[model samples]
Target: MNKLLLFIIVFTLFSCDSKNIEQNREYNYPASKVWKHGVYSKYEARDLEGVFDGLEVDVIYSPEKNDIYVRRVVADTSKNLPLDEWLAMLKVPSKMSYWVDFKNLSKANAKQAMSIMINLLTID
Candidate 1:
C-alpha cells in the first residue's frame, strides 16, 4: 500500500506542467514540440534584433506553462548595452516562428478570442 501511494504522489507532481503565453518575447520555452500551434502562419524565419519589439504577435510556439515571462527593460539601459552583449543574447537560430494578432483573427470569433489573454494575465 505504501508503494502504491508513493507512485501516485510522484505522478501527480509531474502532471501539472503546461504552457502559457507571456507578454513581450522573453520566455523559457522548451524546444518546439510541434513547431507551431494556435493561429500561426508559415513565414520565413527572421533572426534579427529590434524586429521582435515592433508588434504584438501570436508566437508560433509559446514557452512552457507560465514559464514565459516578459518585463520592461529599464529604458535607460538600452543605449548603454555593448554591441557584443546584445548580439550574444539575441543571436539565436533562424527558424519559422509565427507572428499573429487579432487583426488577422476571424472577426466572427475575434470578440471572444481577444479577451482570452486578458483573463490569463489578470491578477485579482
Candidate 2:
C-alpha cells in the first residue's frame, strides 16, 4: 500500500511538471519560410529570385528526346524550355532553393531523368 502511494505521488509530480512545461511554451504563427509555385520559366525564376524562399518548377521528361523540359502539361510540347537552358538563365541560383515538381516521372525514365538532373546540378 505504501509503495503504491509513493508511485502515484511520483507519477503525479512528473505529469504536473510536464504539463507546466507545455503550458508555458510559446508559439508564433506563420513561419518565416515562403515557397512559390508555377515558376516553370527562366523569366519567372529570375523575377522571383529574392521574392520567395523557395521556388517550385514543373518538369516533364521526354524519353524520346532524352531530355527534361519545363512545362505544366506533358502533352503541350510547344514553348517547352529545356531544363538546362531554363536553369542556365538563373541570375542567382544559390540565392533561393528550387523544388522540381516532376510531372511524369516513371520507372522507364527515372534513371535517365536522374542522370540529366545530376548533370544539371554539376554544371557550374
Residue lDDT tens for model 1, 13-97: 8877666445597865534434322221112222333243322233211122221112123223223332122223433422223
- Highest-scoring model, TM-score: 2
Candidate 2 lDDT tens digits, 34-59: 78888877888878877887788899
Cα lDDT computed for each candidate against the true fold: 0.34, 0.81
State how far residue 72 of model 2 sits from its true place (Å): 1.6
Worst 10 residues of 1 by lDDT: 60-69
* TM-score per candidate, chains pooled: 0.20, 0.69
Q: What are the C-alpha RMSDs, in order, of all predicted structures?
A: 16.0, 11.9
Off by over 4 Å in 2: 1-32
